[model samples]
Target: MIALAGAIGTGLFLGSGKAIQRAGPVGTLIGYSTIGGLVICVMLCLAELSALAPVSGAYVRHAEYFVDPALSFAIGWIAVYGPCVSVPSEWVAVSTIVRYWTDLHPGIIIAICIVVSFLTNIFFIRVFGEVELISAMLKIALIIGLILFGLVYDLGGVPGQSRLGFWYWVEPGAFGEGYLVGGGIGRFCGFFSVLVNAVYSFAGVETTSIAAAETKNPRRNIPRAAKHIFVRVFVFYILSLFVVGLIVPSNDPHLLTSTGNAAQSPFVIAAEKAGVRVLPSIINAVVVTSAWSSGNHGILQGSRSLYALALEDKAPAFFRRTSRWGIPYLCVIFQSSFMFLAYMSLNSDANTVFGWLSNLTASSTLAVWVVVGTCSLRVRWAMEAQGIPYQELPYSAPLQPYLAHVVTWFSSFIMLSGGFYVFVDGHWNVSDFFSSYFTIPLSLALYLGWKLLKGTSIVPLEEVPVGTFIAIARANPEPPLRKKKGVVGWFGRFWWD
Candidate 1:
């Protein structure tokens, strides 16, 4: 549930509003489901690695042991930056949600949201987990209810509302016929604009692997959870998108353009179009809940990534500090502090800042996924070379090294060419160019700089301290079982008093 809440956020709810305008319904749906399949492939690769390691650091630890230490360091630093960049973006999203309710200042709203999210993370780990579980449940219930309601409405099950299966699709055709008139690549460019937009919607599916560390029984639970995540995310995203497209024509006049406001949400627009009185307002409220829940969970997961880095001495030692309740208090405070700055954008031209931050972070995440798949392949090879018995492995990835390799290349192609759409569209202004491309160089620079300063070579598996790594993995050990108590049947002597 934490994984679901973290991944499906304002990116899908609100950001898709603009995407629909650009790509039309058919293109946007195809683009989202395509990217979703790729994300699932990446998740499958991570699942195998998680089953092998099942540790707090997850992929980072696997990278260190199976691949080069430099790869581990690079990916770990990127993981730390993930939430640092994402929390602010989500804060801006929540502020936008509040704007729907009143004319209150966005800055003030962003501040309040950040404070609430930070406070939630400051409690015990179990308490935070329980809260996230409940929030996730709410989101799941809302999406399921919406889907069922839309299905029933489409079947003419609701009074005075006729079925609209091909109505909108026929009216608008597949692509917007006259929407962005003048045929050429320019028209097609608008459709391809959704590629980057889709990436954001699929962002945090990796959280399942991240949470594997804290799961009570990872070997048994992690794979089950991963499969569940794949099915639920795919269903919710594809079905919700299909329903929205069916109800709201792609060329709806109110659909926001690139120059339009960021506060618009596709779900809101679709509900309003369906003419189901008050449904639009209800969806707006649901979206607000979704944004708050997303931001809260992002903050939680991001801090833990920092804690993992600190434990490995790859990050500043201060991030390792925890409260009595086992919460990474320092990291949470640091993460929330960054989120507060998102409010400043509320008053300024922070949209540019948000755009840059989001692009860079999304690119970094794709890079991390590529590394994860590559590291999995390396782990399999190392196991084979060491004469490890694969047959006895607790869980094995289907198709072994081949699927991992293919997915690695697939992710690499996406990351490598992801910037081209923006570039070709001439949206490559100085800020956008730097924001989109900077993470690649910055990650490499940080990794190499740290290596040069520390004078450390990439540690081989044999040279790496297995005991130290295992000790870190076992830091937050599960509770031990109580010994069976003997009956007091024969008085004190029988009780071993």
Candidate 2:
């Protein structure tokens, strides 16, 4: 549920409207499911590896062992940087929500949001986890309720009108004119645009392993979490997106509303069209908390990532300092220091800066996904070449290197093509172009600079760290899955404890 919460927040609650508006219903589904496929590959490979040797910086540290120090340095710092950019973006979002009621200064709201998120992480790690669990549960319940209510409303239960089964689909057609460039090209471009939206929406799928060391039963629980991802993601993202698609037309101008709340939500838009007056406000309140939840998630990830970098000696030693409670106090503080970026929202042109930051975040995340697949390929090949059997693995990902290969190329394409819009003839703007493609160059600079400066080379295929990790996993056997005695046991078995 925490993983799901990390992935499904303001992106779905707020951004889905833009997706449907751009790609239409069918296109939106295709985009999301495509990215979901890639993410499944990521999660499965992550499960296999994290179960073997659950570490604080799961992928970052894994990249160091299985790939190269250069790559790990690049990825580790980017992992630290992801939340630096994301936390403040979320704080800005909180201020945007607050603007609906009071005219309180945006800077003040951003400061408060930042401090609140920072303080939450400053406490005991378990306390932060508990709060996150509660937040995740609330989000899960809200989404489930919204999906059910949406289904009933679509069937015309509330207003006693005729059933709305696919009515909006037929009227607006399956795909919109998109950017209105005309027929097929425009629709294809629209769908491609939504691919980024889908990527952003599924951003935090790696959360299961992000804090691997903290998990008491990581060998068992990490895989368990990964296995549930498909079902949970399908129900949460696909079902809700389909419902939103059904009730709201792709051409609806209201979707483009900059209300910064549920007024721009497709779910709320559908409810209003059905004459429901109160659901929008209820959902609007959830939207604010959703942004705050994202910020909280960022802080947790950011601090842990910095701590991992310090452990690797890739960052300052101060970040390695831990309190008596086992919290990496200095690492948390280091990430929290960047929270002032939220105050950029005080100026009207902050969107320009925020947009660039968002693209960088997206690019870094996409690169990490690609790196994960790469790490899997190297490790799997090494294990196989050395005569190791799949049965010896702690958790096995089906399809082996094929899944990794596909996701590797797939994510790389997204990262490379992020700046496609700039090449759209007249659509080129200096800021937009730089925002899209700058991350690619910046990442190369980090990787190559580290490689040359440290005189590091990629680990040879046969020399990958598969053997050592296998031993570690073997040394740490998890308790057998517990069996419960009643109907509640059945629920626990299928879902969770």
Candidate 3:
């Protein structure tokens, strides 16, 4: 539930309003669904890998044993930074949410959220899980309720509400006025602009895979969770957008002009149009909870990745230290501190920093997913070479090798092309472009440099250490049911207990 809550946050509620503006409802919805599919593929890959390894540092450990050590190092470090960056962003977002209810200072809200998030991290796992579960449940309930309400409103089933079916799409012609289409290629560019934002909305669906290590009965639980996650996210995201488009025209004055306002959620706007009273405040509260949830999960994932890096000797030794509760204290502290630092941007103009930071993070995330897919492919090959019984694996990803290669290459292409959006759109400042786009190439350089310094080439399948290989392949304990099956031959005749 924590993973679901964190997955559905500010990215869809607040950030996607701008995406609707750029891509129109139809284009954006389609793009989001496509990205959701990509995420599902990645999740399947991770699920199989994690079920085999079932460690706290799910992807980080997978990379180390299957791919180049330097790839693991780069992925681990970036994973640590990813959540830290998100923490401050969530605080800032929560501050914005608070401002809707009161004129209290943003700084006060930011400080309070930071302290609360910090405290949450310091507590034991169950406490953290409880908070996350509640937050996730609330967000899920709100989204589901909102979707149902919108459908009723559209059907004129609600009191005093008129039918509002498909008007927004037709009048806007699916692209809105002033949407330039210089040539065939230019139209594709406009569509691509919307696609990027849709992709970003589906970014954190993989958070479930990050939770694989800590989940009880992960062999069964993780795979079930992953399947449900993909279906839920896709339905929720695409359906919400479709409903929003039905009620609120893309050219609605509020959304078109209120680019930087805190109350710019399309959900809120749609609710208002549907005669839902006090909707803004309700959505605002949900948004705050969502942001906080996002931050909590972010820190949890980051710390685990750091712990994995330490285990692989790719990060500082302190990160490897686990408390009695199996929490990596030092790594958590390191990640939380970075998140606190991200809050420094709140001092600047909110819109500018938010756009820049979001773009950077989105690009970086895509790059990381690509690497994960690549590593999964390598793990597959390594498993085959070692004569591992692939069919006996607890979780199997469908369309092996091909899907992995397609997703890895596709994500890499998108990561490389992301920079051009800033340039061609002419909306991004030079600083924003550099900060957002350069992270991809910069990460590559860092990985290569580390490999050179450490004298660690990408280990061939034959050369990978037997213990390390076994560690990943044999991480999950055999289930009782499986154990029972193993001794069941002629069991009816023997009747042995």
Candidate 4:
């Protein structure tokens, strides 16, 4: 539920307008579908690893055991840095989203959100799952409602508006003349730009793996969550975007306008055009919850990652300290301090700051996925070199290391190309370039610096300890899966056990 909920937040509710504005509806669909497919493959690979190890830090730990300790050190910090920026980015989103209703000072809104999310992380940490579960359910409901509303508006089901059915696509002709060019070149740029935007939306799909250490029956549940999440998130994202395209024109000026609220959303614009006066406020309200929920999730991921590092002696020992509830109180406090960065939205255009932060976090996310793919590939190679049958694994993902190879290279490609527009003759911007591409070099430098300092080497394929982990799994076997009975059983399966 956390993974499902995390994937549907600010990027879809707010930032998607940027995508629709850059690429036309068809281009947006193509880009999201492409990224969505890649995310599914990544999740599949992660599922195999997490189900087997179910360790703290997920792939970060997998790297230490299956790949190299230096690799783990690099990826672990990347994980930490991702949420530091991403959490504030969500806070900025909340501040802007609150603007749909009033001129409530963004700082006030940001402060309240930070306080509430921080408290949730520190005090009610045990109930974090319940809080996220409720938030996820609400987000699910909102997306479904918005999709249905979009379909009705597009088909002229509303009283005043004429049927819009694919009118925008036909008139705008399906593709935008993209950044810095025209015709075919511009169209390609436009589509590629959508890929960059879509990366942020799909950034957190691997949370199932991240939370594996805390989950019950992880060998069964981690893989189960991965399988379920891919389908739900894919359907919701594609359908919502497809419906938005049908009702709202890609060329709509409002798509580019930053109102810091639902007014900037394509669905909200479509609703207003259809004479649905109340929908903007409703959408804004739900979206604010989504932003807060995602921010809270960032705290969970970031703090746990820091705690994992301390557990491995890669970070300061104080970060390993926990409260009676096992909450990483110090780590949470440290990660929560980044919330002050949200105040940047007060001094500058909230939208611009958000764009910068999202780009940085998006690139960081790509780097994380690249590392994850590498770790998974190492796992498979170890199995082969050590002569362990696939059946010895807790769970085996289909497509072998091929999917791992494709996703790793593709993620690297997208990460590097994220700032391509900055290279155009008239489009260069220093901040934009750094935000889009800095993570690449930073990650490389971290890996190289640690390797040189510690003299660490990548573990050889034959010595990766696959047989040791398999023996551990066999010795402490999970309880056998059992069938549930009656209506409650049906309900459990309908959602989750």
On lDDT, the leading prediction is: 4
lDDT of 1 by residue, 75-192 (tens): 8878877777777887777666666667787778777887777777886456766766776777777788778877776666677778877577676655554323345454465565
Expressed as tens digits, the lDDT of each residue in 1-497 for candidate 3 is 66677678787888777767666677667767777778878888877777666666667667777787788778778777666565666676676667767888777787787777777777756688788888878887888888888888888887887787887788864655434445455445555666556555666777676656578877766766777777777788888878876776767776675334666678878877767678777888888888888888888888877777787677778788887878888887888776655555556665555556666667767877887798778777776787765575667788987778877987887777765655655565687677567667778886898899898788798665433635554664656433244446556223421
Error of 1 at 194 (Å): 2.5
lDDT of each: 0.71, 0.78, 0.72, 0.86
lDDT of 1 at 452: 83
Give the higher-TM-score candidate: 1 or 4.
4
Give the alpha carbon lDDT tens digit for every residue of 315-350 in model 2.
888888998888898988888898888776666444
Write down the lDDT that model 1 would get: 0.71
Model 4 misplacement above 4 A: 258-261, 477-497
- Order of the predicted models by TM-score, top scorer first: 4, 2, 3, 1
lDDT per residue for candidate 4 within 1-497, as digits (tens), equals 88777778888888888888888898999999999999988888898889888887898889888898898999999999899999999999888877777888888988898899899999998888887899899999988999989888888899978888888888786875464698888878888988878889888888778868788988888887887898889889999999998887877888767655557778678778888788888888888888888988999899989998998888899999999989999999999999898898777788889988999889999998898799888888889888898889988888888989988999999998888989988998998999999898889998888899999999999999888877877887788777699998887676643
State TM-scores per candidate.
Answer: 0.85, 0.91, 0.87, 0.94
C-alpha displacement of 403 in model 3, angstroms?
1.0
Among all candidates shown, the one with the greatest TM-score: 4
Which is the winner by lDDT between candidate 2 and candidate 3? Answer: 2
